[model samples]
Target: MKHTISALVKNRPGVLAESSTAFHNNSINITSISCGETENMEVSRMVICAEGSDEDIAKVTKDLQAMDFVIKLDDLARKEFVDRELVLIKVDVNKDSMSQIMQIFEVFRADVVGMGQKTITVELSGDQERVEGLIKILHPFGIKSMCRTGMIALKRGDE
Candidate 1:
């Protein structure tokens, strides 16, 4: 099963590396990861996806908390949450086809974040399935390139 863990770690050099190295040593494959500094002191929020059982996740969380840099560890599986990922797609465009593609973008509420002579980059942020649905909708149009952020989530309700 895929497990999502949210970790609060001290924003110090090599902390992330050490934590990831531990997972690597355990033969756990990290499918997605996102990290960013939060406002409270030098702390970072890390979201990691790995294939592990409940017992394995428990062990991982326990091991991580032993590290000095770790502040708190949360297993998102136990919470009600909302998650999203941002996607940027650059699509091939021509003068005649640009207007048609723009209409499609309007339908999906995608924003044109960047534009080049022959391409337009659209940004979409939503649930995983909705994001992929937009991608499928745009597939009829040629895509030059695409980029996606790993999933980020926040638990619902007051903590």
Candidate 2:
């Protein structure tokens, strides 16, 4: 199983490191991590993923919340949130296919971020399914390189 955990912790040195070390000690492998500040200097949102059964994740969550620097924690299951991923892809291109490639990008609302003699880099941000779909479409055109900012998610309703 995979769990998406949102942690609000004190924005101080060693807080993030200690929290991550706790997860590590529990044998949880972090699949993704992203964090940013909020209005409160002592609080920041941290998103993380790891493979663990719900029970195991809950235990980890409890441990995390008990940490001195942690302020709040939420486990977002499939029901309560929207998640998205961003990816940059560099695809092989030629003059003959340039227009066609542009059309494809237009259809997906992907931006052409950079270009070289043999490649064009596209930047795309969307739901996971949509991003994966775009990648599948671009594969036939020869993807030279790609980078992904793994899934970021937030609660859906007013909270």
Candidate 3:
């Protein structure tokens, strides 16, 4: 199962390493992790997506909460939340394919962030499904490369 957990931890070196130890101890494989500055400069919100059993995930969350650096931990699976991922896809483009690729980008609401002699790099940020859909559609155009920022999430409503 997929477990989405968030931790507001001190913005300091080795914090990420320590927090990840909890998951490692539980034998959970983190599928994706995104960490960035929060409104408070002293802290950063780290969203981690891991694959593990419900029982293991529960234990991992407990272990994380016990850590000193962790100011807060939110188990997103327990509440309504929003999650998004950002991806940059570079696809082969030519006179014959440029127009079609542009149309595909328009349909997916993707932005063309870069253009090379034979490739165009497009950027999209959305839910996993939306991002996957765009990638599937763009495959026909011959993907040259891509980079994705894994899932980042926040719980809904006032905490």
Q: What TM-score, computed on C-alpha atoms, does each candidate reach?
A: 0.86, 0.86, 0.94
Query: lDDT score, residue 114, model 3?
Result: 92
Task: TM-score winner between 1 and 2, please give it.
Answer: 2
Give the worst 10-residue stretch by lDDT in candidate 2.
71-80
What TM-score does structure 2 among the candidates reach?
0.86
Q: Candidate order by TM-score, highest to lowest?
A: 3, 2, 1
Better of 2 and 3 by TM-score: 3
Instruction: Name the top TM-score candidate.
Output: 3
Best by lDDT: 3
Task: For residue 134, give model 1's deviation from the true position in Å.
Answer: 2.1
Per-residue lDDT tens digits for candidate 3, residues 40-75, read 999999999899999999898888888888998888
lDDT of 2 by residue, 10-126 (tens): 899998788888888788888888788887876888888788777778778888988988888888775588888899999999998899899999999999999899999999999
Q: Which residue pairs come into collision in candidate 1?
A: none
User: What does the lDDT read for residue 77 in candidate 2?
Assistant: 73
Off by over 4 Å in 1: 53-55, 95-97
Give the TM-score (vs. native) of candidate 1: 0.86
Candidate 3 accuracy as TM-score: 0.94
